[model samples]
Target: MKTFTLLQEVVHIPTKKKGQVITTKVDREGKQMVEVKYENGTTGWSIPEALTNFIQDSVDHTGEFLSD
Candidate 1:
């Protein structure tokens, strides 16, 4: 588990279905990225202030999640 912030922007478009959303974030490297969150609580992306800079696929129950 890690800590990060989310910007109110869409790096990419996501499904309008429940629990599926795409957001834009500035990672720890200061790179703007697109993140897609799924209904199952899994996610795909890089978030602000994260340790890694790659899109990851994992469940994130925490309100705050960082992609690997």
Candidate 2:
């Protein structure tokens, strides 16, 4: 897991649905962040670590994916 402090304002994010494949970009320090644009034309930011734990937990329960 990684963390970051945003240096600049994000301009856009593509729409994403549940279970959709999304893209993440990391800074030089390896902080994982996702850029998302909302329906109302607002950008949203999220850290992968915030969701990684939950996803890993779910996968662990179902044995569908492996977590390290």
- 1, model 1: CA deviation in Å? 29
TM-score of each: 0.27, 0.34
Give the deviation of candidate 2 from the true structure as CA RMSD: 9.5
- Whole-model Cα lDDT per candidate? 0.44, 0.43
RMSD vs true structure, all candidates: 12.6, 9.5
Model 2 score (lDDT): 0.43
Tens digit per residue, CA lDDT, model 1, 1-68 = 43334423222223332233356656787677556565566677743333332234333456867799
Candidate 2 stretches greater than 4 Å from native: 1-23, 50-68
lDDT of 2 by residue, 1-68 (tens): 54323332232223232232144687778777775443455555566543322233344354467689
Question: Which candidate number would show the highest TM-score if scored against the true structure?
Answer: 2
